[model samples]
Target: MAEEIKVIVFGLAHEEYGIEVDKVRTIERMMPITRVPKTLAFIKGVINLRGVVLPVIDLRGRFGLPESDATDSSRIIIVAVNDLEVGFIVDSANDVIDINTDSIELPPEVVGGIKAKYLRGVAKIGGSRLLIMLNLSEVLNKNEIIQLEEQEV
Candidate 1:
């Protein structure tokens, strides 16, 4: 039997993307983000999640996709990488599915305008569905993580 891994699937610009469930802390509805000055264009800002203030990034902007106003379906997926927790603002977070490890293939140079460097792999699921796996470490690089940490305090 092929090894199976669970993933949290989210939508961005009508495309489906996934992140390993182990890396996800929680998924929250769209919340108010307090914008900070001088941050990158994609860095939406920080949001007070429960008691912890987490930096939020607009995935659409990060991936250079067309932006849409947040609707009730919008979500913030909190993921932890290298001990830093950050929230990704997505169009919607609507599924959790398991995929066979053997089904994952190396990403092409670019997928939906996002560079392969920020992608883990691509997986085919549900017969005709394609899921793009996110490489969180690359999406939030060491330097970017440091910048996010500074946004905390």
Candidate 2:
């Protein structure tokens, strides 16, 4: 039997992306975010969730995708990486599936306009569907992490 990993799949710009279930904390519906000054463009500021303030990142902006207004289907995915817990605003998060690790392949230079440096790998699911796995560490790189820390409120 092949090693299977559970993935929390979400939509971004009409494409599918997954994050290992272990890295995800929770997924919530779109909520109000208070903007902070001088932070990164993609950093959509912070959100107050159940008494805890979490910095939020707009994944579309983070991936350099076209900006679009949030809709009813928008969601906020909270993930913890490198001792930092942050929220990522995604188009929608509606699937959780188990995938065979063997099905994953090295990422090409670019996938869906996102650079390969921010990806872990690309997985082929059901032989036709592709899932882009994000390297959270690289997505929340050390330098950016420092900046986020400084903006803590």
Best by TM-score: 2
Q: Candidate 1: worst 10 consecutive residues by lDDT?
A: 144-153
Give the per-residue lDDT digits (tens) of candidate 2, residues 72-146. Answer: 999999999999899999999979999999999999999989999999999999989999999999998978657
Q: Please provide, for model 1 over 5-38, each residue's C-alpha lDDT reduced to its tens digit, 9 standing for 90 to 100.
A: 9999999998999999999999999888999887
- Scored by lDDT, the top model is 2
List the candidate 2 regions with Cα displacement exceeding 4 Å: 144-153
Compared with the true structure, all predictions reach lDDT values of 0.91, 0.93
Model 2 poorest 10 in a row by lDDT: 144-153
TM-score per candidate: 0.91, 0.92
